[model samples]
Target: MQYDIEADWHLLNTCNYRCGYCFFTADTLGDKLQMHASPQQWQSAFDATDFTWLLHMTGGEPSIYPLFAELCEALTKRHFISMNSNLSRPLQSFVERVDPSRVSFINAGFHFEERERRSGNAVFLENARLLQSKGFPLLVSIVATPSALARFEEAADILAQAGIVPIPKILRGSYNGQRFPEAYTEPDRDRFRKFAALAQESYREMLNTSGHPSIDMFGDIHLLYGEPSFTGQLCEAGRRFVNIGPKGDVIRCGGPTVYGNVLAGTFKRAKRAKPCNTGGCIYFCQKYTSGPSGPQETRSGFFDWVADVIGTAKHPV
Candidate 1:
C-alpha cells in the first residue's frame, strides 16, 4: 500500500500472443527474448536506491522474462511488485516463491480472441484461479475492440463458466485499420459499459482504493467518452512515479526527460513536480495532474515548495 517510488517498468516486448489491438507488431512480439541482467543484478540495482519502491513490471508478457520467478523472488525480497500479464505462462513457481503481501496487483489481461484461437482458455482460467486462491490482488480485463465487443457476450459466458467477469479495456490506438473507441458504434459503447460496470462491482474494493494504473477500470470508462488532455497541469510524475524503459532509461512520465538508467546505477529522482508537457497514458495524466492552482504562481516561496509535492502527489497514482 505504501512505497517511496512507483516505477512503471517496461521490462521487455516479446510475447506469445499476437493480439491485433496490441501496440506491438508481429515482429516485435516475436522478437527474441533476452535478459540484460541477472536476477541478482536487478535486485542489487533497486536496492542501491535508498527508497522503498513499488515496481510495476509490464511487458509484451513479463511472465516470459528469463528467470522470471527468480527475478520476482529476488525483487520482492526487498520491494513490492505489480504486473500486467496475459496469464499464459506457468505460474506455480510464482505462486510458491513470491509472497502475496509483497505484490501490489496482477492485471490478468484476458485476450479473449487470442485465447480462443490458441485454445488456451483452460490454462488462462487455471492461472487466474490459482492467483486468486493464493490471495493475490487480481484484476481481469479484456480489450474492447470492434471484434471483441461483438463477441463480448460469448467471452463473458466463457469467463462465467469459470466464475470470472472481465472488465472492458478501451482501445486507444488504431485497430484493424480503424480508430477506436471512436470507431465503435453506439452499440459497442453500450455493451462496453455493461461489462465495465460488472467488472467494477467485482473488484470494487481494490478499484475504489488502489486501482492499478495499468488497469484503471474507472479511467478506462472515462476514456470511453473522450481522452482528456493534461498539458500545463502540475504533476508529480518525475518525483514520485517514473516510467522506466526496457534497458533502464528512466523517463519523467512520457516526456523526453531522462533521469539516467536504473540498471547502470545512475538514475536520479526529481526533487519535485513540474507542469505536464507530454500527453500520454490517461491514467497517469488524470491521477497526477492537479486542479488549477490559479494564476499568480511564484516558485520561490515556501508555500510553493510545499504545494509542489502535496498539491499533485497527495493522492498516489
Candidate 2:
C-alpha cells in the first residue's frame, strides 16, 4: 500500500495543433519539440515509487503518441487511467484499447478562434458523437476568451445540439513577465455568475458527455498546481509528486524551470532546500484565495521541494 496518494499527470509532448495561447512554451509553432517517455523511462518512473493508485495521463495530445494504446494497457493494471485530448482522431482507435468506465470523457479543445478551420469543430463533434453513441464519456472544454463570452449563447446552442457539454475555462495569460488580463474586473465577475447560473438551469436537460453532467474537470487544477483543497503557505511537490524528464532530471513541478535543466539529483538524493522561485510561481502551485483582501496561500511543503529540486533559471542576456 502506498503511503501517500499523488496525482501524476504526465506530459508526453506529442501533438497535432499549434494553438496560439498554449501554456507550455514548446507547444507553439516555431518550437516543434516532442519528447515522450519511452517504455524504459516509464518503467523507471513506475519503479521509483509505490503509489497506491496512479492518476491520469495527459499530454500535448495523448492520441498523437503512437504507443498511447500500449501505455493505456500498462496503466490500467495499476491506476485509474484518463487522457486529455483535443479529439482530433478517430474514437474507434482509442476504444480498441481503453475501457469506458475506467476512462474519463475526452476534453475536446474547441478551436473557436480559428473560425475558418471548419474541420476543427467538425472533428470534435464527430469524436463526441462517436463516444456518445458508444456510451463513452465525452466533454468539451473551451478557454473562455473575451470574445467567447460575448458569443456564449450561440456556442452553447451549437454544442447542446451536438449532444456535448461545454466547460468554460478562465484563461490566464503568460508567466512572470507578461501582464494579467485587465478584463477580469468587478462587472465581469457579476456577469459571469449570472451567465453560469443561467447556463446550468437552461442546459439541465442536456446529456453532457464530459466527466460530470456538464463540466468535466472544473476549477483551476488544470492551470493551478496542487488540489483546490490544499491550502497553506507552501506545497509538497518533491515529497508528493516527482516530475522526471526524459533525461532523468527531476524538478519540483512542471513549469518554466524544467527547460532550464535544473537537475536535482535522483529521487534517492532528495535534499532539504526551499524553492526561491515561490514568490513568482506561474503555475497553479497553491490554492486560490477567495477574498479580495486576503494574502494568498499555497499548499504545504512547496518551498521545501523547490529548495531541494534545483537552482536558478539562467535566461540568456
Candidate 3:
C-alpha cells in the first residue's frame, strides 16, 4: 500500500513505563492521558485531505492512547499505519480489530532493564509473540545503552523462546551525562556489532521483503561509527513527509514550516520536494534528500523492498 505522504503522528504523551534512556522522563509522561478527538473525527479529518496517508503512529506510547485500537481501525480504513510502541498495552482489541495488511509495520521497543525492574517482560514477550502470530510486520529492539547491552544475551534468550531476537537500537542524545554512540567503549561497540549482525540475519527474511524496521538497524549500526551531517540538502520532507503534533499540527519534517492542522482539515501540502535546512531524524535526511557521501544506504534488493514496504524516511524513521 504505497501512500502519497507519510506522517510521523505524535498521538499522545501518556505512557506506561519509565525507562531511564527515554527522551520523556517519568514526570514528562505523567499519569494524565489526553484524547484530542474521537476515532471518527480523526478519520474524517484525513478524509478531508483527499490524500492516501501512511501515518506513523508515535507517542510516549501510542497503544496507551484512549481507544487506540479503534483509532487504528478507523485510520486504516483509507490510510495506512505503522506504530512505535512498548508492547505494554493489551493488544487483544488491536489484533482482532485492525487489518494486518493495512499496517505497514510495528516497531516494538523491548525495554529490558526497565522491564526487569518492573517485571513486565512476560507481558512484553506475550504481546510481541501475539503480533507475530497475526502476520504483522514486526521488529523488536532494545536501545543499546550500557546496561541493556550487558543484559542483551539474557534478554535475547528470553525473546528466543518466542522465535525472535531484539535488535540493538543505538542509544542517541545524552545518557548518564554522556552523549552516546560515542560514549560506548570498545567492548561495548564489539558487543553491539555482534548482536546487530545476528539480529540482521534473524530478521533477514522480513528485511528482504517487507522493509527495514521502523527503527533503521543498519543506519543505527553505522551511527555507532560516525554521525553523518545532512544539514542542508534537497529533501522531500514537506511534500512527501511531515511531522504531526498530538493535536494534528502538521510541520514539514521537524521544521517550523506549518502545513496547517490535520485535525482541523486545513493542511496545505507541498507539490514537490525542496531543499531542507533543518536537522532532526537523520533517517529522513538520509532518505528524502540526495547527497554525494555520508550514510550511503544501498537501496538494492532488500532496501528496494523497503521502498515498497515503508517507503523512505517519510519518517525507518
Candidate 4:
C-alpha cells in the first residue's frame, strides 16, 4: 500500500485583528491569550517526524509570532512548509532567510474589517507583491461576508492590478439563519458567482459543474444553497492527515478525539484508511485528507505527491 502524510499545525492563537466572523475567537480558543508554542518546541516536534512532511502552519496570524523567521528558516530545512497568515507583519527578514523553493505556498487572508487601521490594504498588497516578486507562491483570499461581498469587486481589482488573483472564500459562519457554503440565498449565490467571474473566467466554469455536496481539490461544495454533511463516510484522516495543536495534542483530521501527543512522538499509524466516527466534519482537514489521490505505484511517489501539493496550492482556502 502507498500513502502520504500531511499535518496542520496550529502554532498559535494570538491574532492582531478581531474580525467579527472569525471562528477561532476567545470563546473557541480557551485561554487564547496563553496559547502559543515556542520556536524550540515547534522545531523539536517537527524534527522528530521521520516522514518527508508537508507541513501547513496556521494560527491567529502566524506572522506575529516572535520567532516567526527563525521557525520558518529551521522548518524549511527539513520539510516543505506552507503558512496561513493575515499578512500584517514584516516580511523582509523572512524573504532574506527562508528559501522560497522550500515553501509550498502562503495563503494570505485579506481582512476587510481591518483595512482602516495599521498599514491597511496598500501595505498588505505590497507585502504580497514583494513575496511573489521573490519567487514565493502566494494566494490572496478574502472572506465573502455581506459587507465584504459589497466591496468584493474593488478588492479583486486591487489584487489584479498587482498581478494577484483574489480568491473569494465562503464565510464559514452563519448569517440570518443561513450557514455559508452549505446554505446561501439565491441573491447571495449570484453575488458569489459574480465575484468568481471578476477573479478569473475559469472560476466561473468551476462554480457551475462542480456538484452539490462535492469536495473538490479546492474546497467543500454544496449546491448554490444546500446542507453539508459527512456523517458516514470513511475518511483517511489520522492515517493520512492530522491536526497538531499548539501544545502537540494530535487530533485526527480535526475530529474531536485526541489520539496522543505528536511532540512526544507517541501516536501510531494505521495500515489502512479508517472510517470516520466523527459526524459532519467539513473543515479543511477533512476535505483535503478525504478527497482524492492518484495511484501511488512508484517508489516515494514524489512526483505524484508534489502534483497533489501544487493542485492544492492553486486553491488555497
Best-matching candidate per lDDT: 3
What are the lDDT scores of the predictions, listed in order? 0.79, 0.49, 0.80, 0.63
Q: Name the 10 consecutive residues with the lowest summed lDDT in model 3.
A: 308-317
Q: Write the per-residue lDDT of candidate 2 for residues 184-271, one digit (tens) a residue.
A: 4445444444455554444444434231321222422232222222223334445444354534454555433332221222343233
TM-score of each: 0.88, 0.64, 0.90, 0.78
The window of 10 residues in a row where model 2 has the poorest summed lDDT is 220-229
* Number of the top-ranking candidate, with TM-score as the measure: 3
How far is each candidate from the true structure, as Cα RMSD in Å? 6.6, 9.7, 5.5, 7.6
lDDT preference between candidates 2 and 3, better one: 3
Give me candidate 2's TM-score against the actual structure. Answer: 0.64
Clashing pairs in 4: none
- What candidate 2 gets wrong by more than 4 Å, as runs, is 1-4, 7-10, 25-48, 115-118, 133-137, 174-178, 185-191, 198-217, 220-232, 242-249, 254-317
Model 1: per-residue lDDT, tens digit, 99-207? 9999988888999988879998988989988998998888788888878889988888888866787888888878878876667787887787777777777777765
The TM-score between candidate 3 and the true structure equals 0.90
Better structure of 1 and 4 per TM-score: 1
Question: What digit string (tens of lDDT, one per residue) describes model 4 on residues 1-317?
Answer: 11256677777787878777777765543435553456667667767766666677887777876778888887777777788888887798999989988776687888866665564777787789889889876767787777777787777777776776666677676654667655555566667766665554534443343221112213322223433344444566676677777778888765676668867877665556566666433444234334344212221232233335434222222
Off by over 4 Å in 4: 1-3, 26-40, 117-119, 176-178, 200-223, 279-317
